[model samples]
Target: MVESSHHEKDEALAPAEMLALVRDQQRSVEGQIAAFVPLLLVAWGVAWLFGLGALWLIDGMRPGLTVPPAVAITIAAALFVGAIVLSAVLGARSGRGVRRDAATAFPAIVYGCTWSLGTVAIVAVGLGLLANGMDAALARIFFPTVLVLFAGLMFVLGAAIWRAVPMLLLGVWIVAVAVAAPFFGYPAVLLVLAVGGGLGFLALGALSFRHLSRLRRPLAGGRRG
Candidate 1:
């Protein structure tokens, strides 16, 4: 009985077993940190889909077929604001109780602030140009395309930090759309944002969820075993 118990203990402490345990713990930590990612993606997807879609309907299509531009813009603004709020809340909640070294935390803090600061800078630049007599029609194309481009760059930065291939791909897609939007022109550009950017978010969110599910299954089996 003593030898049998010793053998079992040795098996548990073997290098392979130790490595597997560490891997499982790491996976668990990653899952917890990423739990809110899908929700954030979906929220943004909804915002882009309906908000930009509304603008496209009002400005891109026949004016008679949709609500006024004012109303459409208002709706879009509200949705974007809601998504921002949701992202902030979710991000904070995810970090609760998690400890990270300065190396890891610094990048995340800077990146988060970049989203806000970069947005303000872009808005200021856009408005400044408009005030300087950039044509109203041109302003319409300028704002959305530039903002989309900023978002794409941010995504690329985020992917670099996280080493996420999917995120990098998404960023590339957004950049492509932004670059192409100018050629599409005003209201038509809105159509591109609505269909391309909006749907991209939704699709990415779905894939994230699917990936998470697969991760969970193995963890669950391990726990059961």
Candidate 2:
């Protein structure tokens, strides 16, 4: 009778124990995500390098070699579209569970949407100006507007949401560049957007990757040994 009573007690405790174990695992996953979320920086860096680098090269061509506007715009659009798609995919993969993953991805998705909508609005305004017989000189306003939007997005998402220092710094740098870009001319403006921003992203991406690797190495080593 004692043995049967003990068995009943064990069974009674089993579900509670199982619940505790699951909660622990979920916490562990959340902790990992909190630590490793910056790994997404590496992906973002690569995408920016490719997209902006291509656009810079195309736009930098001398008069004889200038790319047609349609071609340049098409290429830039495709590259940015690819980057957004990849970012979404990467964010989705990093997220572990439905609710948690959605929480993780929601800010980024919103950030992306903000950039997309802002860009469209800016472009529409530019088109309207052009249709109203504005001179081509007004086209220069586009980059400054874009840089402002980029800075705002970084501040809102990186500083406010993720609390990423590098991103906040980048926002400041972009604002400075945007302020000075008009006086410096197109080449300088494009150079800041492409080279300066690309290098900053690359550096942050490298640092984030190193941190993640360090975080993972012990676990990997333990598993291997």
Candidate 3:
């Protein structure tokens, strides 16, 4: 009886079983990688939606009541800062307990640094242009378009790293919005970012949540089986 039990335990899984196991593992890994994406997207969506929307309202792009631009800008800046802080905390938390070789960790480190450095560069350049007599109206357009374009490029790079099609699509959408916002001119450009870019992020976040739910269901069913 002991020998018979040992033999059974040592037997290889059937081909179908092996394939199913592989697929389950793949889903698990995908879920882990994607787990934080929806939250991040939603957070940014809120920031862009209400934050940029407030800016749009103050810009007097349409004929209606308006708030102080300073007030709108301050609220937007606060929301953006909150999002950035949350992203950093969540990103760091997600990597905990994951095995990290230099090859695997290097890209993430570099990518994080790129965001910091690129943001600084944008600020410096904007300030330099302003000091050199760039018009206030132009400055408003320059800052948002350049910042949004930079974010889009970073998203594309992240998609390449993770092989996530949804992320890739989001990046493409952001790039399109940034490119097109300029044609709408000032204030109106803000509306484009608020409505188009903001709504896009929220929509993608919802879809991603649904996808993640579907991914989890199979894994749960497999475990039960």
Candidate 4:
């Protein structure tokens, strides 16, 4: 009789143990993301600000005073390359202890590839339209379109994977800014990317870091659950 009772008790505790394991796994994933948040934010913030500033300077404030095409190309290349390098370094460093199962790894790879390809495609399309001498009205829509597509994807992916409210909100904010950019015109679009978007990212990064800090203290005290 005692043996049977002990067997039942062990079975009951098995599920609870499983539940605790899952929660810990999720928390660990979140923590790793938090560690990398600051680096990613800083890299992107610098890229947007620097790239927009370069574009504005090259394009000039008044009409017909634009810098040479070579100068603009060089600036864009440098900013993007630097941002890419910084992000790679941060990812390698912060992801050290994070467990990567197929379930998590596959989604991350897909999201990253999609964004990289989508951004490149958008740039290519814009350049093609400009080269073909597309009308001013159509040309003006290009930047906004790129912003909407990029931000929309981010919002969807973040909502799906992390279910992070702040990330979702940031995506919404970016999309709204992009939609409003055309009304304010080109200079305003630059300001939106550099100042508005950068600030939003920085805020999200800070929030993530704070959340990780809070979780650490509690989890450190004892095994959660």
Candidate 5:
């Protein structure tokens, strides 16, 4: 009877040990992820802001398109600050832990907003350049690039939908458009690709931010039942 009792004790210990091991692994991963995600968010935000800045500069240079540089800068800065302010004011997270999710989601929003803004700028420039009788080579560079960009965004957004099947299908569709666009002819092909891709990223960022917003509280801690 003593031997049987000893065997039961050993079995119980193995499970406890296993649980401890798993928890340790989880802690390590979560710490590393927490460190890296916030940095990525800031980088993405800066890049998006720069893209808009470039767009503003390009437009301001053209005659009919010209706007006050100070005005452009002010507007862009406002947008950037607005986003930061929104996070601070609107985030519902009840704990610091859930804030990590918001931080992670912020990059997605930045990336999406970046490309969407890029698309708008390109469209404006394209029109402005057409009106100004600019060189054909410039259009050759801008339009197709914008299309491919849009397509890429669409793919990202689709993935961000947080559904495996839909994201996978969206990935396929995005790839098909990207590959086929070059054949459609310059500018047109690029536009197709950019719009398709850009849409995905835009959608993804929105969904991710939405999800993070909903997660304003962390999971309750305790042993599972």
Candidate 6:
């Protein structure tokens, strides 16, 4: 009886070891993604979506802003570089989780709808700014307030709902642009938005939307190790 019981324990240990080994192999495979190309992809995502329109505000590109062109350029460049590093690190990191069903897919699907509607509003705000010029009260109120508010929302959403690294960073930059806008003027602020906001979103949206499922797959398995 003792020998028989010991044999059963050994048999159970074999399958457990096999599962652990397979999980480790999966993590190894996923770690390989943290490379040069993935960083580029992350960089692209950030620039297009969030930073595209805002870039017009940067110095040299437009004259209305108060800050010197060189200073503005330096700030913008730093943000770009930082965003790329952050996104690449997040993307390359891997995890495991249970696979999703139709219900689970809804969050990603619905998130875009708000973004779509908000885009129209964002475009209108831009048009308003351009059409109204610097003197208009609405432009004064709209650009800083609306943009800051929007950025905050996106930051929260990116951090909370989507857990999107690019979006979260984009949100931070957006808030920064809003703070700088009143001091620098729309020209400089707009440039900041373009480099960080428009470009950030475009790049992030592409990367997150495309790779989110693949990235989430491992997390669902509940086995990071």
Q: Which candidate is the best by TM-score?
A: 1
Please give, for residues 93-211, the per-residue lDDT of candidate 3 as tens digits. Answer: 77665677999889988988999899899989999999999999999999998899898899999989978788889889999999999999988999898888899899999999998
Encode model 1's per-residue lDDT on 102-208: one tens digit a residue: 99989999998998899899999999998899998999899888999999999999999999998998899999989998898878998898789988898999999
| lDDT of every model, 2 decimals | 0.89, 0.64, 0.88, 0.70, 0.54, 0.57
lDDT of 4 by residue, 1-225 (tens): 999999999999999989877877777666766767766766666666666556655554566777665886588679878988878787787778777899988987887788778878887888888889977666755654475548655875777797777778878877776666566666556556656666766776677777778877655654644
**Regions of candidate 2 where Cα sits further than 4 Å from its true position:** 1-43, 63-65, 68-71, 101-112, 131-133, 143-148, 221-225
Model 6: how far residue 124 lies from native, Å: 3.7
Candidate 4 lDDT: 0.70
Query: Which residue pairs in candidate 1 have backbone atoms (N, alpha carbon, C) closer than 3 angstroms, thus clashing?
Result: none
**Pairs clashing within candidate 4:** none
* Model 5, TM vs. native: 0.34
Q: Model 4 off-target regions past 4 Å?
A: 1-29, 60-76, 135-141, 144-149, 219-225
Error of 1 at 14 (Å): 4.8
On lDDT, the stronger of 3 and 6 is 3
Tell me which of candidates 3 and 4 scores higher on TM-score. 3
Top lDDT: which candidate number?
1
Residue 109 in candidate 6, Cα distance off native in Å: 0.6
lDDT per residue, candidate 5, 80-150, as tens digits?
Answer: 56656544443332224444577668766775577668778778978898889977756765565555546
TM-score against truth, every candidate: 0.91, 0.67, 0.87, 0.71, 0.34, 0.47
Sort order, lDDT high to low: 1, 3, 4, 2, 6, 5
Instruction: Report how far residue 107 has shifted in candidate 3, in Å.
Output: 0.8
